[model samples]
Target: MTENIAESIVEAINLTKTFHPKKMPAVVALNNISLSVRAGELTALVGPDGAGKTTFLRLICGLMDADEGSLRVGGMDVTADEQAVQDILSYMPQKFGLYEDLTIAENMTLYAELHGVPQNVRQERFARLLDMTGLAAFTGRLAGKLSGGMKQKLGLACTLVRSPKLLILDEPTVGVDPLSRRELWEILQTLTKQEHLSVLVSTAYMDEAALCQTVHVLNHGRILASGTPEELRHIADGRCCDIAPTSTMPTRMLQSHLLDDPGITDAVPVCGKVHFITRKAGGGVAFLSKYPELPKATPSEERLEDAFMILLKEDEEKRSSNIQPPSQREGDREAVVGVSKVGREGSIDCNVEGNASADTDEAIVDITVRDLVKNFGDFTAVSHTSFDVHRGEVFGLLGPNGAGKTTTFRMLCGLLPLTSGKLSVAGVDLRTARTEARRNIGYVAQKFSLYSQLTVYENLRFYGGTYGIPARELQQRIREVMEEFDLTDRADHVAGELPGGYKQRLSMAAALIHRPKILFLDEPTSGIDPLARRSFWQQIAHLSAKGTTIIITTHFMDEAEYCDRMMIQDHGEMLVLGSPSEIRERMHMPDADMNAIFIAIVEQARAELAKEGRKPA
Candidate 1:
């Protein structure tokens, strides 16, 4: 191996971390892991929860000390020169240390002064960050009042105030909107090129993985694999394929069935499809022939997640092959149904030419604005905005923080009162039939909404009971949900104790308990691992198969493709609503991801609005 320390900005050698537990022996957080990060490069630290991603970031930032290992930043030892490391590094923790009550400008100024950034430099940097993050007009707005995505951007700006050599971001986009995420990524790209900054960002988003020059896959407190996206993809060994099934069951069934077959290795859900990894050659074709109803086989490119799954499976297989204890020699169990499905709908509303379900040949919607209007203290948050939802959508609602996606959703769920215009669910008006209208709804909030103190089972029970489900009926429903979400073991765990994915799963199950006619999901998949997100969508697909309509709003554009339709709302105005493909077509841009399209749409809309002498948000 080449040891070019002169060019390397971050170097780690045999790094190990351990935590002492009250009742048990010391637990190793990182074990003999070695890696290097270079200047002008973005590195992604990826893995499931409890995978030591946070620990790794902490060690690099000198937030904590390693038990046995060495880490160097800018040729300075992290353990030996703690203050020196802290001085040159910008570490944005997963929970941004922002005072919510502070104004955006105040927050930036606070951090800048602490870092002793020159007044002139601070003003220049603040202006650039505010404009780039689209918070130029909202500098006086309270940080707490900002949307999740905006808050993330402000936190990033605060971190950048000092202009550190190395930037460490931990799950920075966990709960932001897609447009904001795209902007943040663009800013990072600019910083890397202009400042030659080294960025090490930890994320659960696979799409973000593509932006990184190097991706380090960590699991169970150890580095599993590391490489560029292209190099990592080869680990799949040509077994991955985009297998379109006749329906969703085959996807899950195939995932389970493949585990039982010796030739197959692993299967992960992605973009309304299943990515299967199996041994190369004759076995895949022969096994696939067993499911003739599905579309004919076609070799698909391997994604980063696919490679991660393949490596994880191979790791397991290697462990199994070793002479170890029986506890470790495990066989494949029945694939549980609790994981979410892909190609799930984005909103419950779909516009049909004549019939209610006629245009739904595609799943997911682009947008659905139903005379959505809201008011507070005689102030109108939204006016009578009427729009339709198209299929395969990644719609966005843009505004300062309160321009009304939440308000619209609240009314749709009968949580808020609407002043005017018709609000329909699928085809039924909520005013006339709220119960019937909400049968298909799912909703997730920016904050944790489920019972934090209650166990997972108790929370689900509460939801089922509130829906007036009979005990006998509810029990079966609970079992099915638990199985589908892989929450069976977590059934007894406290809701607060569960990881982000499990909490999200419980919240979803609660929303879905009624088996509603349509689903209303608000930011449902934020703040979870890439694998967890894929698994969550798997359940969404399963629900869609039962003909349940889904409506969700999110800030992640990678997720936009899963929707059947989408719409973009800015300053309470419906800017655009169409299929993901149509949205791209409207922008006349190909190969532009959903986030990029959203940016273009908002920028173009703002430009037109400005030319008309109208204030744009």
Candidate 2:
């Protein structure tokens, strides 16, 4: 009931968790962490994997007991009054626990009954949840048939069926498409404001973190830092710069070259540029001057990630510098590494095909498909498709779920046999030179395919060996990647244990182990947080600069901006292709950004089909 409002809904005191591994003696998941979450506020639990974020969520939800200390949800002790807390709170785990066999409506109804919601409220809440989640039109649709984003919405709707006072969401947006993620967030914002709900959401996305009223950064079961995004960024001391490169390869090389140099605190690849944080102003310029090969350097301010990186680095240095405590060096590292910085934020569903007629001569045609057609029994997955991915360019292939993008991607990777037409990669016909084509292309599939049980190093080694990487070269490459990607510390961490961001980085490393001439990424940044996605794109930009052709297919339109060129496929047909500007222009929108253009174009297409009395497929 909205009548009763408590100040502190969730509170924890000196929470601790420990477990022993098979060979290892012990591992502490949470180490003496204490926190308080207030009512009618959205709090973000931000962290990488093994940070005990999930464990903390579970403890507050009464799913488990902490080895030390206590937790209470809505003023009820979670451990002492587990059932009471469960009734008052709703916990949506990272997985969301959707029943695939059930239809959307059935799933909601089932959860409603479980929560003992009154029959009268059940129908009303069900309708509201569906509308909020944009699932009203497809309540009859099987839950298994929904897309990643849609399924997440359905899960959220089910969790909200009973209108619990406290809501705990664990990585709810993982693997969801950009449009779906935005939609979900919109619903969350509305629910929190309208219902005055107290929400504790854990996420990997920094952009989402920025949306919260408060944030707590968890690392190795401890709060590394806690505050609002601005508060945390203030600790950076003004020392980060977004370095837009005139050339991608040189920029990436410059970033890697500076990794061991103490002057550069953190360097990550971003949308077509390398972003770096330094210990002091002009450090980037100074570093670039040392490498005459690099273009004239630019100085900028540190971002949230920059601050996070600086903090992580400070933590590392403190551990290594026996005489120095982390706090002691805080002032020395106090510069907020930035020429001037702020997180780039906006809508996400901005994408479409390009229409730029400008100089096509520079485009290196890596993959050429003409009149491509693929069909399964009684169904055509792809039909009359054509597109070209230029050399050293990030290309995006976008469409809704079941829109044939995956099928097309599979055929391009030579994982599936093409029904007809020509498909060539790196100037070689895939049909005739499958081995050579495969050799020249690196691919990270939608479903993670790495050895989950193995350590990061072991998995990389395994992939490198499989790809025929020379032992010495492989070792060197592995070491370079580990250090450059800041994954050296996680080299021994179990692959499955690595956070979503690290897992993506590891997968990319394995895919590129052989240094393929062309890279194919299928929804590479799907499940991770915005910060991780940005970092991952930085790596991609690095590769693209090296003349490595990149063909990426993603549902995140905002990501399309990083692409030199992109193509949109809908219902097994090529709808558009060109750069972001060109695609926006094609929609006849003046100065509208990608998201607006995308919505306009899709809606226009749908309306046109309706007007023509042609049923849209």
Candidate 3:
């Protein structure tokens, strides 16, 4: 409200949007939301999926018309002078269309031409962007051949081919690795500071939002709050604390127990500790006394995410009490085997007795990869990689986009064959007995792979039937799963029509219809909102506690902290392996967060590769 209208880069007054599909009921995507982005400032629209962030972005870019209200961009009426508004702003959508066959340089050239950049200015601009993005060496590499992180950087370079008054990026770092994410932020920050560029970015990551000058929190088509990061942090003042577990209980268990308390607003496991927020302001000490089982609690600095969740909790409380807390779900399922205590190095000691059966007292090593090698002609995707995943352990596989993480996962899941190696999963050799190995594992692909036309219940039934479950049992199981996932209300809804969060839940439920011993998730929380991500991980933690071995790949570095052990790879080679804490200590940056550590490791690997005269693809 204090913004100067004359100096604002973008302004919206009483903006509203609604969509009417062919047969479905009209959906109001945005309610009467009013906000402004000041010139030369970075503004963030922070929200969960289906929160109208994209709708607002599209309206400002003149890609769609608002059903009501008015919007102005660069002091021009967006609806009246749409083209003029567009000419002064660049928009990078969730999926920026870079031709796969085009090289990085060619893609930039194409976008530059489309924007009508003068030929005389093209060379210098291209040089600056390439150098800034660290893609100068890969200018001739086809976009299709570039790694996921590289492709994102290229997409950004293309978008910046012609400097505009404002830049709008929608979830630009959805699947980008930690290193690339940091690089992209650096570029944007440089542009904003030196060129006086105005940017409006919609993001799911709270840390990214914290970097913005102003953040607008949206949910259910409404703006929950808007303020600077510090101002937002004040919302949770004196309410946040770190609760350390007294015993060896998993952090997830402590988190679940804390969340069950009505006074608690939110609780999440972070760095082997539970960082929790309470509803009562200035009640940290009193709250600690209520949980005597927990070790001495200490006040912690509030983060933007804490404030965001506090706002969301307040909103939810005002709305209704019908929604159940996530912790209200059924007790954890029993694990197939027991796990060993954490070692001095903070690594889980898997008491592995070779090839133990389900009835045996000794624990079994669920997955074993020894001397694994995968080849595509002269290129190696995985080289002599060896690791063991114990039953019920949360094992994380991390790397930059083209680091062969996916290829390694494919071979382990029996989806891809290894050129030469020994691979065993669930006591079955993946190379020689793929069917048996696959039967013991469930895989949820990165993308939604369920039938879009089928209803949620139908999809569940189909998956159960595919696993050859009895019709009667399958029906009951589907109902139970639907209820557990909070999908019972959406049972009749088509899978494709569901929100991103619901689609993810349905996918996981379908995959678990047969209750496989191991679950494989690839970037499961990529584009979801923070709250949805918390719920998703809670389910994962519950499943792991119940004795389900979980193997996952994710670009969100923060999620890595939850894993018992993790393996970091680059260019088909393992660079580091250990618990999150151990890896941080090895890097000798105890205070550095996961993102910093990940960037450091990848950079070190690339440096070694350059020394070896090997350029990463």
Candidate 4:
């Protein structure tokens, strides 16, 4: 079939969608938003969680109808010819359901048959997609057996079984690792450049959105700004700068302190320093003068993230709400809040133990993974990995998909059995006496693991009971957690229905119910927006300050900077381990950002393996 391409492949004019729950106030998901996806160009929808990016994409795909305005896909009105529009476009939702039972090739064939892709063209397309996604050799693997990144790749391939004029992806990189995320974008860019395909994608990562030719910044179901990234960047041109915090204050605490300043727009940790944006174009220097505690500002180039934050901050100021930002909430200021400490004295007694309990002042090694190894029959998941997590230290464990980081974490958390190694938490041996050791550990999983059907308060109570808290103590702890985490308003709300930020807070609250000495946060801030992330980090800062040993795994390179120490492992092997500065120095590039450093290390490792005629598992 021949093709006809319009200058604007997709267009929306004054589009709006609202949801009205039976007993609640209506939510305006999209409010008269207008945008255009230019033909043969990469377009991005940038927004925080609950910003209506998904709602807008669904409207374009005709999966749902907008309450008002017009949407045209490939110059065809979606409402009038939804099927035709869909036939010429592919919409990849956040959770693209790929049959896990089938092999990768089988899944591709199934999608091809469903799309009526004739046998003649099926092989060619499958080959092209597999090659493009770097999954050609993995065609025989079962979908369920593949890693997260591989599954996403196969999902994308299935969506493209029959090439569409326009490709719509809703946060396709949401949970994928940096390596896979980069690969996914490379595919999209090639589709736009080589095949002249128009691509529209929504992303939580500012770096990903900045790569787009056009970006529409969304907030509260409205287009806050729409322009090229350069134009958006100019929004904070003279307002952005980096300031080193005083030796006395922590970077995260400094960020929280600065956010309270009226003249400051946004403040976040960047490479262990505070990178902030001011209210006006030239307001950074003036704003710094007011805070004698802060050092002189070093001007930095603006970024799409700085611009997005400024817009969101400005918008929040115009609207009033009963719920206050976490930073402004007075209840959780102290790291050592209402939690009653559990004496680790009865737990592990080895000299190998030490994360101080909330009541203690000694900082010692909290966890030890000595020659840790995990294997699934023939596959070694974590090969002889070892690390020590000190009390009150924030340690980051990062790796690409299928890189053994998750395996290492599972072993540490005692969720999985280690094939061989000495594992210790709070000085208690993990290999034996897991039950006793678990008492001193709190784990927040990558995904929301709370009971969605239950209310927030109920979830907290359940976790407290699970942790063996007495009825009287559990009730009091629940109240304390609710107050400390600012979840009082959401206590009665169903866990599943809560927004991303609240859900995260609920998870943390549930985890903190036992007040475990070691906290394991597995990608806790994966899909949340920047504002929520800042608030989350502040909470983390508080927890760490109070002698909590935090061992976290995340896909966010920027967040790695927040770690006091971090280790990168790939293909079941340790690649590098050090603080941010130490890592940069090791790479011999003093100014290299975490992303660049990560890519370099992983690539170099893979290259060396290739030279030795071996492929990463």
Candidate 5:
């Protein structure tokens, strides 16, 4: 290591890790990677799933020993002095364990005692942590009842009961909402600034990576690039453009079309426009002119994501002679004709001249909820919520964790009963004919719900059989869907053994086997990579254009931009409802990014509730 051992907080020299299964091929979790982290700095390790980020963090924290090479944490040899290294460092894995049955105060006290914190100062430290994490008010509440975001915060607090010299977090905000993510980042920033803490965090979000003082991009167990956000953005400089679609075309449609061009490195729908990067530097203009229907493109500032995608694409191209990049897959281009046909059959008419709730003409409504309410004993999960979703529209439901988004979605999909009010799907009242209504809809749950022990093909076949498709037709449909999802090659692979992207693709494939009119996706892109997300959204765009109604719940705020309309919910109540642009205009923050807008809306809602002499749940 070139860096002084006394000055660097963490250092790794030619480190490698390999995992050997009993009968399977050896998996290289980390290659010969070298890096150094200076004291009192926030260093980020960013990559897609299966990129060895977790392994690196584990090695550094002495949770796992490296197979070869040297590693040091807090100026101690991690492999030789594992306990000593661990004593000075705190590691929070992706799934942090907390005593759910205990109250927040009890959990914090337990962790503090375990860390050997002095009783004299423990009370003061606990008070500060709870206040800083915004959980002081909920100190007496059971940890199990806390929201996902709250649980994450509590986990952080427990880890920090007695501050270690180094803190390592693995995907700390994986499924956290935009507002909660902002809060968590604020806490981390304050610790780094005021306490002079050293943090090594692994994350998949580019936005989070941009916040770090230094970032290392890892892929397939190798360190591909390392630099500051500004330094990395230069890699894609002059190749990025913001494309405004013509009035006749949707932003997603234009984005899908742009990705079809081989020269276009990457394309994503963002803020009512398509942000894309080209393969050649300064070739953005030339790439735009290829499609006359596209509006005049403007040069946009390059982002860290643009550079990250460029680097991944370049690396893929260099490795394979016949690179079947995810962006250029033929399966992604398949037209989803089922969406349009379903939309026409289920379109709803609203009186635009007067009240938005009044129907002016006879039309189909894919999903209808009126005065919907769900209660668990005395606690209300959903409170008199009402909404109408037309066919072929992409409707987004966003909220912080434990905001009842899932409850509403379950009721709409006929998985749960409403406490009161009417619910309908595809013109069939779910309250009256839930079984029949379910036939017209497909649902992909937040977690992987497929049989993990079964192979991909077996799982698809089983789901198809349950839907009552004939044997011959089921086989044919399974083959076609697998081919469309680019999973034909992995047909025999165990579902549980697949990577994050493949697992997601298999989940969607299984859901669409019956070709339902409406599709419900819950955090579909939660843990996947940027490339996989692009491909998944491309398929979504195709379905939407073909007239399929999509209802989704997501934590990624940027994804709200793709929806025709979205609703923000908190504390079992709707806060805002409109298109992304309309929401921005309503909040008087037209130029603000989605994260800022989300935080502002939620905070504003909480303030309004306070003024009304009511707490937000």
Candidate 6:
């Protein structure tokens, strides 16, 4: 068996899946897709939303028979012997259906019975899984009480009630925190190395995909490329370069402009520089020639994302995901600045330090939270949080699962009454003008928060009217926003049926319908592809430049780099608050990227907790 470790455990030949709904065009999910997965190895399938990843997995699991081609799992024909194939694979989907009302042990027992595990071996199997997942001590806890990471771990444990030769996970770390995500990958590695279990995972994160032994990039129901990490990265070799913008140039603003160049395939902020990819190798210098005043481009190491973008860009049928820059916004919504002490590690800065600047002036306060606190029963979700957001500045709030980000957001938006605090948003005091303040605040949630059943236009009109726009002005505003957002073609499409990127666009359109001065975005770009995420940032940068203050919460550390300043909180207390440069300086990691610095800060806090003999939050 050891000698046969490299044998193919799953193989697909000319595989195809199509859906023909009544009166609708046929949706081809897979077009002659072919791939091979070796036994006891890790493989990854990565793609943008609606790229047929879920459909492909479903076909392999025998949940849906392919319209054409053939597939074999564990040497058994999946279509010809569906049950035999299902018995050898465990599939955990994006939204694993865990019985939240039941205890961990009860949930495991139920899944064991459904999977037909023998009663005699149930206890031993459960014990092993519980121990492996660090959930043994919480068997009596209800699933609903588990944290986001713990719930995902429990779902994984339940999938292993009856061990299978292959384990399939669909974006298991989508909304999980970074620490938990790292831990989960460690668990997967242990399973594959120690138990010799073959694993297949689909992810939107290139970093995660890069860790797998094999990677397959898919789009429009077709595999664009497939190979080992090194082989795939070779596609973008010598094409990647970094442009250190002049000291006067803003990083994000420079990136937004560079993305417009036809020769530049991709542009993103990396470590205070604008890292970009050229459409062709040796074109970096040529692209830089377009911007004569900019510094010379330096060759940078190639990355999986650069390769992914090149493959997607080579396809002519790819949709144009650009968001046109908007005109400057003129408003006088600034408020009184909050007072707090500065220079203390976790204390609020009572005053804006002179010489601090972003795209706009930093002295004018837009939102202020003074001694904010929120308690649900006896549990304090937010403990005396205090901070000030400046006009036109992009401020971010980052924390682990169950942290006070959402709670603080609700208070700022006037959705939830604070237990005790002083807050002001959009020049209106919550103590006096919450109703007026609502008229000037916009919010977009991480997931689809719009009316899914309504058309895009209908949703926009609804929000416009609700915000008290005149009947005549509402239509004009709606048309203007649709054109700006490039959603004219999908105006009549139902919100729920749109692809993930379009869904996010629709949500943003609805939020901006009233032209609010303050925008609150809750992990707005999560689960989307790199292309769409960059496009979204372009729009955000444009808005910030136009003098709109943005307050957001995100788990993606890279996204945090886009903020003018950000704060990281855990266990209802602020740990660090500073600009990206300030954070790197404080950590004494001049060369460390945002992701590394974030992990170090969070892990250091965890280590301190361990040293104090307390459980890490």
Candidates' C-alpha lDDT: 0.70, 0.72, 0.84, 0.82, 0.82, 0.81
**Ranking of models by lDDT:** 3, 4, 5, 6, 2, 1
Candidate 6 achieves a global lDDT of 0.81
Cα lDDT of candidate 2 equals 0.72
lDDT by residue for model 6 over 1-617, one digit each (tens)?
11232387888889988887443478888999888888888999988887899998888898889989989999999988899999999999999999999999999999999999999999899998999899999999999988888999999999999989999999998778787788788889999999999999999888898989888999889989988888899999989988775434556656756776677878898876788998788874454576688887789999988888888777523555464323222221111011111211112231223133332332567888888888888888888777788777788888877767778888888898888888989778987888988888998987788898888999999999999999999999999889878899989887777878888888888899999999999888777777678778877877776678888988777887678778887777777877777787788996777778878988788789889997633
Q: What tens digits encode model 3's per-residue C-alpha lDDT throughout 139-242?
A: 99899998888888899899999999999999999988887788899989999999999999999889999999999999878999998999999999989888
State how far residue 557 of model 3 sits from its true place (Å). 1.4
lDDT digits (tens) for residues 1-617 of candidate 5: 13455768998999999998543568898999988887898889988888899999988877788999999888889988988988888888988999999999999999988889999989899998999999999999999999999999999999999878899999999899887788899999999999999999998789998999888888889888888888998999889888765534555556767777777888886655688898897664444576677677778889999988988778777779495765534543555322332222112222111113223134356788888899998898898888777777788889989889989989988999999998889999988899999988889988989999999999999999989999999999999989889999999888988878888889999999999999999999986668667778877876776667899999988888777677888888888776676677778886667778888988888898899999655
Candidate 2, residues 1-617, lDDT tens digits: the string is 11123577887889999877664458788999988887888889876556788889888877777899888777788778889888888989977788999999999989888888999888788878888888999999999988777888899998998988999999898766555667888888898899999899998666677788778887778888877777787766657666544332333344544553567776664544566777875554455666576555465554566666666667657668765321212221222111011011111112332222334444556788877889987678898787666666666777666667888988888888888999998888988989878988888987678998999899989888988889999999898767666688889889876666778788888888778888889888765545456457656655665567788887666677666666666567666666655566567664554555555655566677789997634
Model 2 worst lDDT window (10 residues): 338-347
Quote the lDDT for 514 in model 6.
93
How far is 483's C-alpha from truth in model 1 (Å)?
3.7
Best candidate per lDDT, number? 3
Q: Rank the candidates by TM-score, best first.
A: 3, 5, 4, 6, 1, 2
How high is each candidate's TM-score? 0.78, 0.78, 0.93, 0.91, 0.93, 0.91
> Can you write out model 4's per-residue Cα lDDT over 92-192, one digit (the tens) per residue?
88899899999999999999989999999998999999999999998988999998999988999999999899899988987788889999999999898
Candidate 6 positional error at 388, Å: 0.7
Mark the regions of model 1 whose C-alpha exceeds 4 Å error after superposition. Answer: 1-3, 18-28, 118-121, 124-138, 145-147, 236-283, 286-305, 316-370, 376-381, 387-403, 424-443, 462-480, 513-518, 575-604
Which whole-number lDDT from 0 to 100 does residue 242 have in model 1?
61
